[model samples]
Target: LEAINLRERKIIPAIKKGETVVLDFSHAITATHSFLTALLADPIKILGLKSYKQIKIIGANETIRTIIDF
Candidate 1:
């Protein structure tokens, strides 16, 4: 929750201000659905699809990619 809050307050604002945001998922070998939702879902909701058109996600494995893409 703390991590999510920081991203919400800082990263989301940066993205909103027209900065490019790169989210690297390499450190985590696996991500739970709840973790992914908490980490990313709110930003998508707040920023909308148009804003995320250029966002980059790095090093996600197939399962993670499937969940995220779905």
Candidate 2:
């Protein structure tokens, strides 16, 4: 609930650009924020939700941010 509120208010702190975040949804769904926008963020993935669009439908546990260098 808190995270949703934070995101809604655009008060998210600096999360790493290459870290997998599994949003917690154990709180009230009515007040919880959907992790959709998160999917578009770099190094971010919408956990616990079905993958679609540009998101991959892999297991949350297996999902990770891979930064490649050449």
Candidate 3:
């Protein structure tokens, strides 16, 4: 699809150092930005994302974490 194509052709290049991008709506999911963000969290920190932002849902919302860790 277009998302896969964009990653193969475009977005990958922009994921380098000192990069700041805003993922909105369609591109957010299509680019699999959340997964990519989680995958690249350490690198992004090393590359210098002053504040590391990871999503945290409290209480009974730990299902995704369980799913991911499992």
Candidate 4:
């Protein structure tokens, strides 16, 4: 959770600065709902859906992609 929070802190600032943030999940096999939420919740809440425009996700498998989409 602390690590997730630290990543979120970095991500949010980059987004705010209008930089494109790429989240590469290339070798990750899966992710828990709670983990995803912890990583994304604050950015969504603070920046709204517009945050999606600044963030890019790549290399997630089907299941992980589905979870993120959901």
Candidate 5:
């Protein structure tokens, strides 16, 4: 959760500045729903849903992709 908060602080501003954030999930085995939500939910709230169109998550397997899609 602390990590998520740190990233949110960094990422939200980058997105607000119209920077693209690419999150590569290649090495990650899995993520909890809470972790995923904490990492993204606030950014989505602040940036608006349209901002999500600019963010990218690569190398997500089916399970991670499914979680991300939600």
Candidate 6:
């Protein structure tokens, strides 16, 4: 949770500046719903759904992709 907060700190600033953020999940096999929600909570709250435009997710497997879609 602390790590997620730290990452959000960096991501929010960049997104505010209109920079694209690439989230690489190459080595990650899967993620919990809570994890993804926690990861995105701040950006979605602060920037709204439009924040999705600034976030690029790569290397996510089908299941992870599906989870993210949910």
TM-score of each: 0.78, 0.25, 0.31, 0.86, 0.84, 0.84
Candidate 4 lDDT by residue in tens digits, 1-70: 8537755678888988888888888999998887877667668787888887887889999988988898
For model 4, the run of ten residues with the poorest summed lDDT: 1-10
Output the TM-score of candidate 4: 0.86
Expressed as tens digits, the lDDT of each residue in 22-48 for candidate 1 is 778888687888777766776778778
CA lDDT of each candidate?
A: 0.76, 0.31, 0.40, 0.81, 0.79, 0.80
Model 3 regions more than 4 Å off: 26-70
Model 2 misplaced regions, further than 4 Å: 1-5, 8-16, 32-70
lDDT of 4 at 45: 81
Total backbone collisions, model 3 = 0
Worst 10 residues of 2 by lDDT: 61-70
Clashing pairs in 2: none
Kindly indicate the candidate among 3 and 5 with the higher lDDT: 5
Each model's total of backbone clashes: 0, 0, 0, 0, 0, 0
Model 6 score (lDDT):
0.80
Query: 1-70 in candidate 6: lDDT tens per residue?
Result: 9537755687888888888888888998988877877666657787888888888989999988998888
**Residue 14 local lDDT, model 5:** 82
Off by over 4 Å in 5: none
- Residue lDDT tens for model 3, 5-56: 5444444445553344443333221224455444444334544554223222
Model 5, global lDDT: 0.79
Worst window of 10 by summed lDDT in candidate 1: 46-55
**Tens digit per residue, CA lDDT, model 2, 18-60:** 3233443334222211343432332234322222222332322
Question: 48, model 4: CA deviation in Å?
Answer: 1.4
Candidate 4, residue 70: Cα displacement in angstroms equals 0.2
